[model samples]
Target chain A: MRKNYFHPKNLDGVYSVYQIEGLNQDRLIKNLKNGGLTLYNVKKIANHKMSLEISVKQDKNFFAIVEKMCYTNLELKPKIDKKRKKLLKKGVIATKSECGYNIKLTRVHGKAYPLYYLFTHVGVLIGAIIFCLGAYHVDDYIFSFEFTGSGNVVENRVVEYLNSVGVEKGKRFSEFDLNVLADGILAENPLLSYAGCLKRGNKMVIELVLAKNGTDILDESIKSLSSDVDGVVKELKVYRGTPLVGVGDKVSAGDLLVDGVISHKDVQIETNVLAKVVVLAEFNYTFISQFDDRETHAELLAIESLNLPVEYSKITKQPDKDGYLYTVTLYYNRVFVAG
Target chain B: MSFLESVKEIIGLEQFPAPVFRATIIGDVAGFFEGVVDVQTWSDEQIVIRLKKGGFIINGKNLYLKKYCAGDLVVCGKITSTQRI
Candidate 1:
């Protein structure tokens, strides 16, 4: 059997090349062999110098002997191939190299590249972030208003009504209900028949339509205004129907004051239109004078929608003292509402 | 084969006291051998290796120990001859 000192285990992991030029190089080789170090490619090129390959895994032991023996005339530079490099990374490794400087090359390169970019382009990155933030929130505010209509509309009233309903410039449009805003616009202006609010790309579009009169008369059936009470007409105003009785005309009950039938002089056809008229009749309203005076509906007349409007007031007899008569005129008009 | 040699082969026991030694020269490019006890003499031209059975002298040009592991060694050079001394 071969002795253990003659051939040791394979020392092929992470080796380096070294050249030694000193006196008694033979002694150095002898010391290396006796120290149980494996050597490869031991060549003698000069009389007192030789070069050899030794494993880097024995860095501390190999350098300890070299430094102790004052072998200062030697140079060692690690030459790594793929197989030896894998061994150094996985299993056998030297903590600090004696052949080179005490510096780590890979860690510095891995950490510095990112920090360099971050420190150099900080302003551009911040600007990009702010731009993205503004783009995300731009849809909340309203900027312009565009009004469109078929007829003439008061633009200022629509704008004012929208602002009063909390739909204004720079306000979040979603906070205000669109339906309420549209209804308020129609109510504030009596002239507008329809009001619709449309939101399109940060702009509010108001659509207005004026009321078309005389076009919505579904019942063109000939109608007339008849007096329900017997009195004298004090004031009379006609807006649509023809007036049959003028002011100071004595009218009795069941009398037609305005005629809906109209006969044209040039045309042969007779047209029937709805009668919209206002008549004020004189009435002697008498009330018992109590110690407490209370207002009554006898004086005030609203003239609301009624199928049968009062065209005259009848005075029966004069009351004695407490029943003294005073005149209360009432306004009666047939208003034709077209929505 | 002798009786002890064949028994040792069958039992997988290594030949003791005198290890086997053999040398192969491949077209003067390299030489390989095993069971070496020591590197006796080394220079640029020759290297004398001592084995258990005997010793060997290798003469060549630019001869170096390519590898030595577990008593197995390789020598590469332009070899003129190899002789057992």
Candidate 2:
């Protein structure tokens, strides 16, 4: 029961109508005035029943005061009259009866927490889980391997060689060190002048630049044929340049059998030396059978690596018995802490 | 004059000489009365009020005191009957 309970109808506010039964109009008026509340309107509908429109300021405080007056009337005795008076001064509703002064205030509404907060918290947790899973998928293992180069070499053969050298695709993206893989490829193959590997999205691209060998690319240049072994040249076919020595010529290793320079009208023209030579040689050799003395052994190797996504091991057969022991020593570097 | 009559005179001079005790029944739910000297006996179902003259008995279900100030008394419930004792 506060003076602010009733707002002007044209204004935006809340008001409550309470029926004060079993009480006289005078007494009711006096109690409300004492509680610091001005009754906006009081309509007597019966001899003992009246509709009271009290001015409400705060809903919680107003409702609590009303309820305390309604339900705790019997408890508002002389012993707690002082407390009751204090509550009344704060605009609490109290009425006197034969039993005692009791309070019966019914609450209709106030500041309550909305029910959607629980669902909102749960939704946020689920969203976070989904985000984490999506991040893991996007940054997961490498999807495929792509090889690019201009060479006469077979693509499958290069891919297999790269796999052997640990430049494999489908491995975890974080575990791959592109610089190290390129270095390893260049080291293993002397015919490749350039080798590089890079990641594009989920795909790993390997680039190779083959070194120009004489048998691959032929152009205008000076070259000489050298015998690979001690032999007698039975015949010769020169496709370019000049033929220095004819058939039945005996040539040793490192001897120039053809020349690539031609002189016409005192102008020397240099061209690539190209020729095909057949050689006949005689040799005596001794062969030994070591199938009975040789042994084949395989060892299952498993390793847990830190830098690698998953731990893996393979059973590699030793080239010789000593090779197995050497491979076991290399296993020490594979074990690392998992990310 | 008795002490109860003196209290009744002081608290309720406006309704004086009309009735030593006046009880007004509102349907069967509530009762408003004056000239209450003291609450002699009380319970959820029955309440006895010592008025300036004789006492009054209020009978009902869920009967509760709504307010009491000096000689003014308001009792609310499913008030069935009120009898002069």
* Best of the candidates, lDDT: 1
lDDT of each: 0.60, 0.55
What TM-score do all the candidates reach, one by one?
A: 0.32, 0.25
Q: Residue B60 of model 2: what lDDT?
A: 87
**Residue-by-residue lDDT tens digits, candidate 2, A1-339:** 555422322122333445555533354444453444534334444556555443334323434544544522423221234655666556454435432433333221222212222222567667777998987877656778777886324344467567776655567777767888878777776678788888777887788888776233444454656665455676577776667667777766566677777778999887677666655432212212223322222112212222222222233233343332222211111110100
lDDT of 1 by residue, A195-261 (tens): 8888887888888887665243366565666777666665555544667887777777778877765
DockQ of each candidate's interface versus the true one? 0.22, 0.02
Model 2 ranges with Cα > 4 A deviation: A1-121, A151-154, A167-169, A213-339, B1-85
**lDDT, model 2, position A117:** 26
Model 2 per-residue lDDT at A261? 78
State the DockQ, from 0 to 1, for candidate 1. Answer: 0.22
Chain B fold agreement for model 2, TM-score: 0.76
TM-score of 2: 0.25
In terms of docking quality, model 1 is: incorrect
